[model samples]
Target: MKSLTAGAEIDAWCTKCRMDLMHRIVAMVQSAPKRVICLTCNSEHNYRAPRTETTASGVHVRARNTGPKPSPAAARVTQKARAEKERADSWSSKTLGQAVDAFTRYAMDKSFREGELVLHSKFGEGYVDKVLEGAKISIMFRDGARTLAHRAN
Candidate 1:
């Protein structure tokens, strides 16, 4: 067995490419490779050893999973949808029954307080969730919360 270390090249199962390819070790755990980057595909992922099975003929064969697996893109889309729903729910709970005219137009020179409604030109309507130190405030908008400068000197 060859000595393994960070930056050493090794044969690893590339999850993205779904193949056994040469990889450069990027991270290590207790002298074992934890993460690697595929030299062929240029994709980085957790280090996985190539699976092999011994057949009845005593020959070593590469093992493969025949089951269907969820793709990374599909998981990302589902996560994005869930996050958007949560944001919409939060925005609705915070802004429910609030009059449009109650929102104060946002300006860097203007001071703001917590729970105050703000109308931003770019980020649309949002409410001041927290008044921070150093003329900063966390505002919750329809999309998400954003930190903005207020009462700038």
Candidate 2:
């Protein structure tokens, strides 16, 4: 039985290279193979031998396979979704009155209370109570209740 010391280099078999090659000592355990790593393959596996300190250039170099890496289709979809969201956020660039008009029409399907703060893209913030006849919409403000013509665009 041999004692394994730190920074020792040893000869070990590399499964990747299918050959016995030199490896630098990285770690060790009591009564175990010195945890040899292959210099050529740069792989670490348990070995029964202690290693010695050797430079990575001292080992025989093997040709690495230069295969094409696969493209990620999922990553492309994520990038496109992010770009679309940025474009949609520019809707705030519209006039406040136009924005209010748009939001009011959109909120037609939703209900509002009497004193609740409602944002009218054009008129800004106002309170709502009831709906009147024709295209006229009622909004209660700090001044009083005022009716505005609602137009759909």
Candidate 3:
């Protein structure tokens, strides 16, 4: 590996020259490698090693944070929206046992074990921790904390 330093000449590919040309290191910025100014084309640009994170399957994995942060006012609106969505999505007035019953029946029909892994219609996704006596059961969800309910799937 070639170590780059200011004032040192390095062989860097020039977009204009279409070949590796000698370049002089000039300015460097934080979090990036040293800057390389092409001597032949007289152009300054930053150069970095081509890198990637690969999964166990050898597939490249890209991390992204696409969620937007909320400003104070925007946060209030978001909270209200979330509350409304919860109210809309909730099976209110219905007993949690009813949900468990429905989920268990579905799982049994599909040949899945009782209190197995499942997705919640509301609370995102989770796994059934265990089936308790009567209608109470425990569910471990992605949002953290275990939930005791009559049904979770």
Candidate 4:
């Protein structure tokens, strides 16, 4: 058996090149390459092996999703993204002209509560998700979540 170590040359499916390319091992765990940098394009990503699943007929079936399921935080982020998209779609139906007046104006020196929709002068419309200490609040806008200051005094 050959020893696989960092800096070792290996073959990996390059995400950038979209083909099997020679790579330099960037990280190794228990003699297995976990991360590699493609020598062809210098792109770094997890090393992926040819994925196959055996069926009852003993045929190697190509796997669809080879990686593990998304983590909880990632799932939450995805959910938040979906919710934001739904909100955006509903926003358009709510009439942007009048909707802008519906959203409470956001003020830096004012107070806000969670679930309160505020219209940011620059960030467009967003809803407060959390209120933190020091007058900082996490608000979800069209772009994404952001922490801003409020109630300076």
The whole-model C-alpha lDDT of candidate 4 against the native structure comes to: 0.78
* Tens digits of per-residue lDDT for model 1, 1-153: 988999999988889988888999999999899999999999999998864321332342233434378899999999999988987887877777779898999998899999999999999988999899899999999878999999944
Quantify all predictions' global Cα lDDT against the true fold: 0.87, 0.55, 0.54, 0.78
Model 4, span 1-153: residue lDDT tens: 678899999877777887878899999988789999999999999987532212322443335535577789999999989998887775544435555556888888888888778889899877887898998998877766789998844
For 59-138, candidate 3 gives per-residue lDDT tens digits of 42323433365679988998989976664444232223345534432222232334455555666444565566645555
Relative to the true structure, candidate 3 reaches a TM of 0.27
> Candidate 3, clashing residue pairs?
100-151
What is the lDDT, from 0 to 100, of the residue 144 in candidate 1?
A: 88
RMSD of 1: 16.3
Residue 91 displacement in candidate 1 (angstroms): 1.0
**TM-scores of all candidate predictions against the true structure:** 0.45, 0.27, 0.27, 0.38
**Pick by TM-score: 1 or 3, better one:** 1
The candidate scoring highest on TM-score is 1
lDDT, candidate 1, residue 66? 41
Quote the positional error of residue 77 for candidate 3 in Å.
43
Better of 3 and 4 by TM-score: 4
Q: Pick the candidate with the highest lDDT.
A: 1
